[model samples]
Target chain A: MTTQPHEHIVKSYDEEQRRLVEEIVRMGQTAVAQLEAALDVVDRRDDSAARRIVANDDSIDAAERRISQDVMRLALRGPMARDLREILAGLRIPSDIERIGDYASNVAKRSIALNASPPMPHVAGLRALGLLAAGQVRQALRAYSEDDDELALRVRENDAQLDRQYTALFRELLTYMMEDPRSITPCTHLLFMAKNLERIGDHATNIAENVWFLLHGDRPLPPRDKRDDTSTAGPA
Target chain B: MTTQPHEHIVKSYDEEQRRLVEEIVRMGQTAVAQLEAALDVVDRRDDSAARRIVANDDSIDAAERRISQDVMRLALRGPMARDLREILAGLRIPSDIERIGDYASNVAKRSIALNASPPMPHVAGLRALGLLAAGQVRQALRAYSEDDDELALRVRENDAQLDRQYTALFRELLTYMMEDPRSITPCTHLLFMAKNLERIGDHATNIAENVWFLLHGDRPLPPRDKRDDTSTAGPA
Candidate 1:
């Protein structure tokens, strides 16, 4: 049977919808890169880089607003099954990206608060956590853009690993504070920075969940046990 | 002009839609109450009350889920103009409510973690902050339900007050930590609890913004500032 004109229009519409989803994923990846760069600023005490991260947040926020508008427009215009899920999922991705930008800006602010210096003894594990979290965020976005549920699941699983790293990092910092009471000032700020990275991991997990919801129409993972994950472990 | 039989059915459908919106507002109110109860638990270190708050979250969660389903069903069936906006707003409200619940749970968790004995210094200010935040949340929900822009704006203003309180509380806690290094453990948990209440205020502001959006179809408030309002006050 010959294709109907309206059907052809819908086919093009689907293409446009897919492109929008891809754009959101790209935006997420950009935000993740910004976060990683902010971590570098934290390590090097690069005030210029920190300021750049803070300023760049506006672009991320604008992207989020644009994506939200596009999603709402798409939903109002009406979408079919798969396209509907993709567009709805697209709405949440930008919020996650914006939050990642917030975390990056947090690290930047902390960097400014604590002037540039050599890596504090307890910061190595925190740095590792940041690198791992950034990687997971990027991977989650890639999995989403490519429609790879297996990759998304892998990204989700890495959240637990990130939590373990954070637990270890916190314990190390706690030990530092216990040994030298004066270390509390920088250590508290460092704790917040670590928390920002952990929250980025959480945003990645949220993205992974969105990917799963788009693919399967249900939450794919069990609710996490906060106690098991957030509790401090033995000295690192 | 004679009305069709289906017109009567549509009228009844509209009634159901209105009821659904009412239910959503109720869910929002319940969430605000949960936050208040959670604050009480934190202030009094009443673990039983905290446990009750935790248990109560499931009910709020279930209510939110039910309202979400209703919104989706109504949207699937078809909604026009005001009905469409109301349903969409109804959908957004629950997610906000669920986040409020999550914040309450965070407060409860911190309460459990701290387990600080009576004479909990630095707590009075935190409790005041929670009460202030809880009030904003309640007023915001009422404004949304009543379509009262004036009340919504009031809620927005209250957010700044909550921020000021959070700053004072943080400074007080910092002093406690500086005075007695051993107080750091409980103080740190108290800090997170206070932070959670402040965040709850932020989310309440978000709800008020959404309410304004629903009423005016435009964002009425300026975008949120990314700075740490808690840390910025000039050393208490």
Candidate 2:
């Protein structure tokens, strides 16, 4: 059977759309791996490995730029409303993933500074928080690729766990700093690292919301809990 | 002379583009004002005012959604490559501005926590950093509206100044915490606030780069220095 011109166009456009989504998912996986690698560096105090992860963030950034170019090219083809939403999601989800890469890089950078002092037990808490954040990002990416709004909502709901973990880490680090003046410098580094992990969770939530926007258009997302209360937190 | 239908369509498209730029500028101005107000509350130690600023962040978020909708509508109109670049900028610039608003709100939130302790001299340093960040955001927005690549580059260059200010503040707070353990809690809050302000500067830089991308599509930008060395920072 001979393929018609209109069929060819439709097939090519669908292929482009599939390619764009696949690229975004790959980029997101890179960011997740970067975060896990960073967490490992924190536990092992591997400054060189941390530096490598920091440099690797550029790949995710390059991915974002490429995805943007693809979206713009596809967009200029006069996409319909549904395709336009896909184009917008293509733009936004990568931006969020790029930021996740940055947060992961920041965590790795802080780990190098964290290595200056003796190891503290708080690194385990940070690891737990980082793992949770990575899971959120992974699930969000799955939701994006699968068009699973249910999974996106789950990712949003799960961010509260990451926030609570961060708050606990925040209070723990503060108490540790107060107990030993010498631990103040390293503990401060830990605090910023923890904040970065929490923000990674936020970025994951953003990606999930973008997935919802992709599927549901202008419908408002159900309000999720924001448990990151460290900004208002006081001494324990 | 009677205007043709095509000419009328061209004029309307031009108007839509102009309106998009103007809306983004206005939204950016709101974020800058929010940051300035957050800095004010930090200086005044006004928890109520801080809460107000936090609540006002919703306006910036709403503006972002509106701008995104406008961009999508324009993009689906089958714009040329140049106009498509503008549409992309419309998406990206507002996202950066929204993040700036979030950072500003975070500063305000932390100020409330900071109020639990005696006011320290570091608030002045924070205010200075915030003003610098706000100026960067304002300048980046102006660059976007005016199509001023030179001004965008200038804004990007000036972020180094913000970073140096942040690093100095980081050292000061760390030293203060090490000397007096009683100050650790408040100092930790100040450190995060400083980080938030520093991040606002980073977001401004992102906007500036987006302006550059809008003006010069696919052209590589010159490398700029990054002076935020706190990630590698140790005891001062």
What lDDT is reached at residue B191 by model 2? 92
Q: Where does model 2 sit among the CAPRI classes?
A: medium
Using all chains and alpha carbons, the TM-scores for the candidates as numbered come to: 0.89, 0.97
> What TM-score does the A-chain of candidate 1 achieve?
0.90
Poorly placed runs, candidate 2 (over 4 Å): A1-3, B1-3
The digit string of per-residue lDDT tens for model 1 on B32-135 reads 88887877777777877777777888898778656765665565445444454555566667777787887787787667666643357677787888888888
Candidate 1 on A1-236: residue-level lDDT in tens? 68697877778777778878877977887788788888888778788888888889888888876776666555555544445566557766777888898888878777776553345765667678899989999888988888889898888887888887887777677677667666666776777788789889988988887888788875546666452234212334
Docking class of 1: acceptable
Residue B10's lDDT within candidate 2 is 72
Which residue window of length 10 is worst by lDDT in model 1 chain B?
A: B226-235
All candidates' chain B TM-scores are 0.89, 0.96
- lDDT score for residue A138 of model 2: 95
Candidate 2 pairs with clashing backbones: none
Name the lDDT value of residue B186 in candidate 1. Answer: 72
